[model samples]
Target: MTEKNAYQQAGVDIKAGEQAVELMKDAVADTYTPNVLDGIGGFGAAYALGSNYKNPVLVSGADGVGTKLLLAIAADKHNTIGQDLVAMVANDILAQGAKPAFILDYLAVDKMRPEVVAEIVTGVAKAAKASGMALIGGESAELPGLYAKNHYDLAAFAVGVAEREQLLDPNNVAVGDVLIGLPSSGIHSNGYSLVRQVLGITTSERFKDLPIAMQETLLTPTKLYAQAVWPLVEQGFVQSMAHITGGGLTENLPRAYAKTLSAKINWGSWPILPIFNELQAAGDLSLEDMLLTFNNGLGMVLVVKSEDTQKVISQLSQTNQAAYIIGEMVNGQESGVVFEGDAPW
Candidate 1:
């Protein structure tokens, strides 16, 4: 075996990894539920499955921040990206009518910085606490060549649980079910590749040059819907749900529809966010592309019976979440989303 005298010269820093662990350990501990059996720095984290669930089904989702990380990097914002990470998976599990139980993150960087790593973990901890999930453990890796200095990537895996009978099944979604649109907190971690193209800015550009509102909107963290949605699920008002992520309404909404049903989204039913409008005009993007790309405004769509629409909206309002009756599921020619009226774009 060849002896390598200096691992630091090769760009991997063992001490930095240890420092990161020390910095984030307390924040990680803050997300622990009574079920969490072990803390951070364990070779493997453990969480006891409580006996509360008789027929519990574990719902798991894995997601990354995508090009949105570039925006975060550009803005020198590390905190909100963790919320985006949790929202991406927690909302997915919520769509299935599950309660988020625990989350673990994977953060990889070319060089490790304790403060940066701790800032990211703090964001994750904030989100995990919001979702009522334990931040059991995670890995922070320093891969010198894979990423550039000051550049890092985040990916997270979340596990949720639902009683078998409580799981939201798309098959339960039927014709005439109304689609309720829950307004997003800006972009919510998707469609940024086009956003950057429209703005024509590099990752290093300070967002300060843009209008303050636009900058804030772009950096707003993804909203966690669990607190609002869980109640509706328990009340048996929500039939199904779709987390509008990468595919926007064009792709995601269909995931919750029965084969016999197609979603008819009413154009102009909800207000489209200004950031989306800015992107469309700047990019000269067509209505088709806009609908297929950005979320426009709606973040998560709840499919409910027509009679239950007002109830759901009213409940969401209590949480300071404004919702709209954006559309309905219909027995149409095909099983997909069909936008009604002229394109708002």
Candidate 2:
């Protein structure tokens, strides 16, 4: 009798793993710039920073797609979430005024399926290219005992570089600075647990009958701000920026402010997407809770001198990014952020 391999009996398919690598190789290579020094299938990815700076600071961020992955798996849509992974980390690094250089992903699944893995990596490669970040390498693990079949999770590490003098510092944010709001794609990758609950996603009937538009809204990928905002950062146009993720504007905007300063957001100044309005009505959520949980409609908040607000807005408009003067920084009381006028909800 032939001896059986314990690893195969445990359900890890080595052949499937090899197939995944072969399928993803071309997609990953497409994201490479001259900086990437090694091909795929290496034990470690290699990149040459080259001699490009007076003072270089490597900025890195690690983040996952959060519960948004659940929805992706539920909907059988695997592609866009990889972009969500890249956007979450790349945008965070961009907050520090860094240009993303490369990214690595971590994908763990209950079972290895080459097609599914390839689809996921294809999306990662797409977003990496779009953000000008090289998709240098990543890991795909198959753990049969840990997750149920068809269940998986994704996380990513993004590395960026900035000149030491050019790194954004919230300490530089001061009173009288204007706050510019950048439009979000939709709900993005945050508050989906509440989103699922609010929308009654667990019920099969509810899931099947979800409004077509609403379904699309819920799955919209996070916006990648690096390509759009990096030029502004390089030009010293942005003093500070907050990427609105899980915390919404109420929490995120303040991250870019000095302690002595508070953000005064004009609640009705920008358009609140219909999806947010729907969530509020469905969940009966108060405006405060909504602002604290979801992004509402703005995905990013940029702090700039009052005099330069128009210039910044105009430049963003040229790039087809709709931006609005959503608020201003003022002497603080106790809260870091304060809203003005009636709540949009």
Candidate 3:
């Protein structure tokens, strides 16, 4: 038998890391914009920011896929989660009305597996291209002690540029502005820890045993919103926007507007995704917990003037993006998100 090298014996494989990089090279190249100045092997990636805006503001967001990674890894599915990683950050900056320009990812694993890493990065590259961002650079860390074998975590930092005056402002989000919701692709990337508990997915084998379609649905990558909402931002059609994430609508909506204003949701205006309903039944969870955690159905919400509501919804439909008017901003004393009617649970 061939003897293991010193580093290999220590659980760090340099050859494997190099191979992973080689495998991901093509995918990474595919996402490069004309502004990209360096290749995958460079010490640092570079991009030339052409003078595009009169007064540019840089918007950045950092996030991980959270426990959603657990489900993907358990199922040995690597392709789509990378997109989830990208979406978490991309959508966040989009909430600020910024156009995503580039992304840097960090992947850490217990032991480097070239094929798996490549698969993950290919998804990332695809998502970056879709979101109009360059996959500029990233790191693949093999930390033996920090993670379990065949286990890994992925995070991304996205940087975007927006004109100073065009950035979405909470101060400008006035009462009477209508709320428009964009549907989600499954739960996106949050509340998965609860999902696993609710579904009783206690082991990799159990997760793997689920019907293939269900597995795919559960692991569906987060939807990129730059294509859907950027046009509205460019046209000054939206006063503010919220990317419903870990905190769901109850928490995230308030961040989009001034504290004096409250979002009043008209329950049952939009149909909740079946997956959330299934989870609620299985876990016997209260409506409050569901809203406090999962997005229930909507992924992104826009604050628009009532006059522009139909125009905004019509434009989204033209792009094959389905949006619904779910609520409106109110001048009432209630703070944050205020529920008006009971959800048709």
Candidate 4:
């Protein structure tokens, strides 16, 4: 007769997973705000709701780290990727003019590595706290046979709330509204699949020398915009906002607005980040392709009336966020974003 062990017998060490959670206890605690009801190691996490706003509408978004995972694997730096995971969802919901309430993370790994797991979770907690969100619940799974030893995946879900009147929509955008652009933290999480496909398997040192600040820019985590845009939204200064993600500016701006109005962007108004230039040179990617594919340099954008534009910029500046007056809304047959000259790509 043979004695059987737990999943630990099959290389998935439950004890090691538990130990990993124990190690992350302190780091996770550092992210807690008044709304977070418990620590990270619970089956369920709780939050206080219904007491903060009138007719609080809950907005939620779930997103993963995307192909940027390859960079983490290549550099062996897992912490910042977790922040990217949180940023993806939180920033998306923030575009709707909602204040983040709580966050939940999901981590799946081929094997249990206490240190690496802790580092990744620490990053998630950091972003959540930075956005004034509570890290309430999450799941960690260890599957030895499902993945390569060095492979893992991370996903995050964030919930936000706003009063019905506080919500922003493009319907409020008039032809005179100005387009405000927010700077991105480099390549962000999109187009990496294309990046790796173009660059292939290069050494980290060589990856660092690819014309731009590859190491710093590539490792740049996603921008969390909740704290920066909340005040503007609360003051009713922002008419509508867009979070540039998978589709670049052209695709995302039409989301919260009606198609009858079009946006004309001034290419020279914003400075294109060096990383984008390098990608253009390296891949010889056309201007149109680049504009449709990446955020270029702008991450989040706020649309405001001409009268309120200065106030919006001043408010954003006070929050340490630089806002660019990229262009203005215009009349067009189509209801999408249009480029007047060249996109600042």
TM-score of each: 0.94, 0.96, 0.96, 0.93
lDDT of 3 at 113: 87
Per-residue lDDT of 18-52 in model 4, one digit per residue for the tens? 98899887867877777777777667888777476
Residue-level lDDT of model 1, residues 11-89, one tens digit each, is: 8888888988888888888889899998876799898988988998999999988988877777777988899999999
lDDT tens digits by residue: candidate 3, 85-141: 999999999999899999999999988889999999999999999999999999999
Model 2, span 1-345: residue lDDT tens: 766589888898888999999998899999999999997888999988899898999999999988888777877789898999999999899998899999999999999999999999999999999999999999999999898658899999989999999999999998899999999999889998899898889843565578777777788998988777888999999999999998888788878877788998887899999899999999999978898899998988899999898888888888888898998999986799988898776
RMSD of 2: 1.7
Candidate 2 lDDT score at position 32? 97
User: What is the model-wide C-alpha lDDT for candidate 2?
Assistant: 0.89
Which consecutive 10 residues in model 4 have the weakest lDDT in total? 201-210
Distance from true location, Cα of 198 in model 4, Å? 2.0
lDDT of every model, 2 decimals: 0.88, 0.89, 0.91, 0.83
Give lDDT: candidate 3, residue 97: 89
Segments of candidate 3 deviating more than 4 angstroms? 1-4
Clashing pairs in 2: none
